[model samples]
Target chain A: MSGHSTYEPKTGFERWLDTRLPIIRFMNDTALDFPTPKNLNYWWTFGGILALMLGIQIVTGIVLAMHYVPHVDYAFNSVERIRRDVNYGWLIQFMHANGASMFFLAVYVHIFRNLYYGSYKAPREVLWILGCVIYLLMIITAFMGYVLPWGQMSFHGAVVITNLIGALPVVGKSITTWLWGGFAVDDPTLNRFFSLHYLMPFVIAGVVILHIWALHVPGNNNPKGVDVKSKADTVPFHPYYTVKDGFAICVFLLMYATFVFYMPDVLGDAINYVKANPLVTPQHIVPEWYLLPFYAILRAVPNKLMGVILMFAAIAVLFILPWLDTSKVRSMRYRPTARLYLGIFFLACLVLGFCGANPPDQPILGHEPSGFMLLDADINSIVWLSRIGALYYFAYFLLVMPILGLTETPLPVPEGISEPVLSHPAAAPTGAAAAPEKRG
Target chain B: MSKMLRKGLALAALGLALIGGQAMAASEADEPRAPSGGWNFDGPFGKFDMAQLQRGYKVYREVCSACHAMDLMYFRNLGQKGGPFYDPKYPNPNDNPYVKSLAKDIQVKDIDNDTGDPVQRPATPADKFPAPFPNEPAARASNGGALPPDLSVISKAREGGPSYIYSLVGLGFNAPVPAGLTVPAGKYFNPYFVGDVSSAWHGKGPAPKGGFISMPPPLAPGKVTFDDKTPSTVQQQAKDVAAFLAWAAEPKQEERKAFGLGAMIYLFLLTVIVYFSYRRIWRNVSH
Candidate 1:
């Protein structure tokens, strides 16, 4: 023990770190060292999996940048060259492209994991807020990166998004001009977007570091919502979690690799293959899969500026999730009412994503199509779904969380650590009883 | 218990045999075919004839370097000689030398000279193919308003590779008008011009049934010698050059296929490992 203590650094960089960044040490002691509830199922592994995905994206993205050209004229062709010519360029490009989808997949799971566990509660509020911020950044980065290819969709997307700024009251035109770097979305726009897309990932990496830091502050919230009381409740993260996370990462990679190699462009838009043509517009302009919910929300509002603002607010509201839920319990396993509503809310989000990806439908509320007819029926459907999704998206935060917090939660108190673990068969009855208790 | 274990082992072996048999069958089915000399102009064509492609590569190396730059392509990729696809083993030994020679030949601007005037001898491989013109005005003056686009992504940028090149080169005179417009004395146009049709062309005389293109057909009728001793014609040379351009545009074809195959194998192995590992870990535990 004495010898082990002596191994600790006494001076220089270690000493400096000890003083300035006590948070890491503190985290290691309190949250990491703090015993975790033993009943955390596979769902809890998603957060670790999500972090691994972020790492994959960053690594693959860096390698892709080595071969990718940023020029509008050459960007799409360069991508083709990478697919066709560069040594193992196809693998790198496919990995990056498919990795985007995988990252979203993991994030969706991670978010759902948080919802299921109520990990957004109390002291972990900052962690949850940081996660929301990271999600928004991810959306922005993906969107901007999509435009770098200068494909038909990319051009239209830029036009649509930049034009959204023109919907503002006073300095709209100036702002649009400033954003475009010209009167229209042209070469300068592509160049600047390329620069920013490259830069934003680094920013996201920094934020992720912060997000993980915040997570470590509270450690992990377990399924039971019961705080750990002793050493018996927890295990060291090095071997146990290291192995678990590693296995999860490997499994995730296998799935990712399958898609990357076999069906790389499954998630991509076909229109993106065609070069950007300002004169001839594509039949459809869909945002990436990740942005579907927000895209739906953007269409939900009638007013342009208001819709944009609402869309921004929808994401911004997620940052305040820590404060919104007044629930004493951390995990939805104990909070039965929160569980059901959260599940429904999750389903609603999925529906919104699906609808957003689909072509918008004509609004049933109106008698005739608008005179302008610039906006399509698909936009209308997206708007309605957006409105509903946005409403639900907010309701889950503002109304549902607070309401569920006040309501009674049907919970089963677990026996001591040595009690026989309940298998799925044994847990069935408990699950059945827990059904009606899902109030939110 | 021992008998039961042996039975389980036998079953596992049988499953492995089945899988192995299937994979063998698949591999046999996917074998690549040697290039055929039949040059079909219509429908899909194999990327290009490998022999003609190699000759075209040589031509590009020797002659085209004087005026044109394939900035999009790498030197070593030409060695994907067996097919239109690239092979990593065939490294371009001339890459460094070619680049150095090019650099020595041309004078790119340093901070001292921002205008970027070429300094001395002609450009070497290291130098960016010196622009035909220093600026937009110079380029227009030299190329008759049409800037020679970078050859790097040209194969991808254009719709059909060989036919486009062939048509672009085979310009001479205009065909008889379809009763619409009064014809000029010397000017000619191609009805099948897929690209900006309005763009002007420059050929010496009346073209074949198709409209005359501005670019005078560069091939001297029977220039490129084919490997199978196929008729060495202008059309053949055009096909060869187009194939070379296509290969240059996308050199990773073979590597992608190889990696894709490898990844599938790895995934199959991974799946098996994970399945066994999961079974091992959960063997004694009751569900």
Candidate 2:
């Protein structure tokens, strides 16, 4: 956590304003003078990358909304018109569409980094939960945003996902009907989705403020996962992190621009170019790639009701992850056994994503009819692979986290952030230079 | 009206017509992968071959226009920047004599201001390319229940862009119906069309690699005599039209890539500078 304000008013106007609101001081304390851990690595850059992505999505989305016709009948053409007719509209539209993917990419990295460093433990629980809330809102926003295009995939994806609510026992059908604003996903549904799609980002922005506030209170979690013991363990955030994050962001933008300029539609499905037809459905109905892992989990359970429950539960489990992880050691860097499980957990998630992108009947290892039959599907099928993936996904959290934490023999942890920096091999060769220096 | 507002209104009208002209049926999947057409517009720095686009336009005007529509395109677009008929001397597409003449050749449906009755008028460069069928039902009826889709974004709407179009028209349509499969009364066999041929397949272990398309092969060798004196083989015709459609799908693609080159270079430089700045700033800290 940051110490007392080091800001001193330098001008007459500043002195007056500081007495009136202290807003400048607040900004300085939170953004510039904040004491960030000195050992934070490139993984920490994702937080800054995520913030930039959100801003990009919001700004581009607003421009798109200006040219966009929200009605289902017009949505597809409106988008095409933007790409074909509007000035630099192609750039804006591509950025917004691909921005959703980029946003998720950054968030996923941020989450995984949190898991590896145990950033969610103890004082950072509230920060992590707020992040989960923002992530949840992002899913809802991205889903609705996709529907605004009214492409074949957009319409059918909405229909399939909305119908999941209908799997409930009693009020399921009514809830779904209410959600759709009719008996089916139609013009009214598109209207409401547009409204919410436009609204959710600001809501996310608000939660993001909370997320940042919570983060600033606990400060940053370093790779070493040790508390900052003194002033020597930290650095001013501005020139150090801002410059690093800026460099990382520019590199990120290079990848983003490549997709935007050269292969704009590669991340998108060709089927979506077809206008949405309620009378017919696409051969494969898949959600966007970011949400694929959850979709895989949902379909992994054969029972519709159970599938829906499991899908929701997967995200819900993240909300309680801080408590579920029983390891006393914060970073996997210290707990070698726990680190292995985390690696497998990450792999399971990717397998789930692969499964989600494909049809369940499709074979993973070989051609269909692999001469081995499992429950309701071939043993080699994506469905079976997804089931195994889903099981590991849940077990990694529920069983592995708790059990491994209590049993794993952790490597000796450093006493403070400075100790790791001082002892590192790179620093050992330059002991005098690496030694912590006292600040005035 | 101000020029900006008029342009905006025209674009809005074109957008509306495009939505109104949307085709209902899904273009079935391709079984055989479409080989690369090796189009001029194939890569990051690729530019459209002006002669090919002009030839492609001739094919569209003479052949595809009979059954298909390109509701999103304006005649002026033909002479706009990067268009098939674009002339560097003519900054305004409307003033391009060739584009103007092409527009005047087509009779578009309109209303007479004086008589208040529907009339046919020679189109201006600003006019949208007229629809082949007035409505979807009529198109379906004429095509035996399969409506030919609007070609404005056909290259983009389908997978593989120009290559897919080239393959479907030139190569796939001519493929022999495998021994077991029966071509239905109206439908033609297309090896590139994506569909399950299982129901129609009576003789195979796996169903043959394509699906039935309502439209018969529309191109033949020398279908349209080229203005550029290029050979008029069926393959050449297919490739040209595909290129034209790709250009039509996103006329501003060249502009996008040009702008991206600068953006990529700028970002690369900024990243390097910032990276060094980070290094210089962190040099003494040694964390």
Candidate 3:
């Protein structure tokens, strides 16, 4: 993709800057004239969508920080004041709040697209690892941002998550105390969280630059999962991808705006509207929807330490996925058996999220007091359901990725991108025999 | 298809079946689900009815305000765009005479500038809605340890919003208390309230539908007279106040929806244009 620079400095000022910086030439090589696989699909557009979401969150967040108060007493009221008094503050705040959910949605799609195409394999492992780092930062950033409002859920969610660290052996309690800046999640905690919340997005942005730079090295992996072999198999990224990504981005924005305007708080917990009270805890405390799968994994095991370890392991496992997968072929499109396992893996993650939202004792199968016990807990309960989901979640990586990849027979892959694109019936008029020439 | 894929699909189908079955079989054992129906502001196109908001305000002022506080609200909010008393001619809500007059009726605690002493003053349009108590401790003390939540965003603060408010206040009291259910001294039974009533229920088929709520049934027939001459039944008052709470929760809702329409149209056109351009640019490349 970065074979040779094609940009020329036509103007006097451009030539001067080209000699000094050559940033114009860099942008041209990476973003404009970079040779990308022509067969990339809508799934590829999520990269651009995620970039747009990060920008939206940062810009809106900076504006929110201008008026937001970090003190526990004033934080709740200040947020309300922004909504009630400041001009278009409601719009800005809602966009920022809902933008977090939207950001996660796009990132999940992008991650899944990578998995399906084996984009994490071989030369692209560093690119995938950089993405994982960004994701971890995003989770921390979103968690801290939720605490800034000093709502009931915000306070309790912080307490619950921070306490998970205390499950460790010796230094756990000390670490928790240090993190809180006191004995519990209090004013000091809120102040530090607000400061870090403002800082984390910029950190995520820095990592994102590395992620993109790593991406440019190997370019994009298309749906075909085949490497671009010749000039005919590729197209200039500028007009080819820019317009397609722009179209997809507009459609995504339409959905985002619908949520921002019509049902801004649908994704948010209603309990969050209540101001934080140290004495009283909410009956049921759940993390934001995006983190539910991990939360479910945390609660699935009965042992506290083991559950914490397992939850962290779930994400840690993804970092080593490139090594776990042993398939010679990259794309699931050519691997029928692996595709099924991946589909089940997808469903398992969704089930875990569903279970996470519910209480551990609540039934997901038989009625309550049914006397159906599976080990220590009821077989009917959400804990059992989550355990099953978590089991499959772990197995998908450790078992399916390692075992199925070696055994499954992949469908024969095309030699080049143009072979399948030209041979496909949709590419030409119905009556045509041989593939037609590329349009001028 | 491979044997493994078939087995995976079978497992997925079985799991889906169990989930679907549970979803249909799950009973409302904790509290009755709040019924949401016939509200003017129900959907994407829904807008607050101004007259209904005015009536709702009367109910809030007369009833709920005695215990609850709307600390986030200001007198100017009532006269802002999409508010009950909004006037297009008066763009600035602070300049709206109706809002000013309404604010003047309430006495707010303040400090005397020169004397350095506490004083009571007539509230201005800019003033926040006065709380019923001086502080949370006092409020809880007065209400028998049950703190009345702020009503500024009550509609968005609860699970079902306006519907939950209406049900808990208006219809909850109508349900007959199950035999052997012990109501707490200060708490009244409301079927729409969420709680574990198993301890209090000694003689029930499965403990009743609801739990003990601190607030007694607040709305009554003819509790507050509407200025618009609408009938002042308990149901009507509850509905009106709920609508008012919804508007108070997000005064800019109508404005948001209105803006969303223009945004949707613009995005739709932009998408269409971009889509066409994308097609044209990639026309030569089959993939």
Q: What's the CA RMSD of model 1 in angstroms? A: 15.1
Better of 2 and 3 by DockQ: 3
What TM-score would chain A of each candidate receive against the reference chain A? 0.83, 0.95, 0.95
Off by over 4 Å in 2: A421-440, B1-37
- Model 3 chain B lDDT-worst window of ten: B9-18
All candidates: CA RMSD in angstroms? 15.1, 8.9, 6.9
Candidate 1 lDDT, tens digit per residue, A1-440?
00111123356886678777765555555334433445556677777787777777778778778888887778877777777656677788878888888888888888888877778876678888888888888888888888877878888888877787886789999999998899999888888888888888889889888886776656667766555555566555544555455566667777787677655656787567666878766545678888888776765555567777877888888788877777766667666677778888988888778756643343434533233432322323333555577788888888998777776545543333333225334335555433223321
- Residue A208 of candidate 1: its Cα lDDT? 83
For residue A18, model 2's alpha carbon misses the true position, in angstroms, by 0.6
Q: Once superposed on the true structure, which residue ranges of model 1 sit more than 4 Å away at CA?
A: A1-37, A335-337, A362-387, A413-440, B1-82, B85-253, B264-287
Candidates in descending TM-score order: 2, 3, 1
Task: Candidate 2: count the clashes.
Answer: 1
Instruction: Give me the iRMSD of candidate 1, please.
Output: 23.8
TM-score of 1: 0.62
Considering just chain B, what TM-score does every model have? 0.51, 0.88, 0.87
User: Lowest-lDDT window of 10 residues in candidate 3 chain A?
Assistant: A431-440
Give the whole-model CA lDDT for all candidates, comma-separated. 0.60, 0.84, 0.84
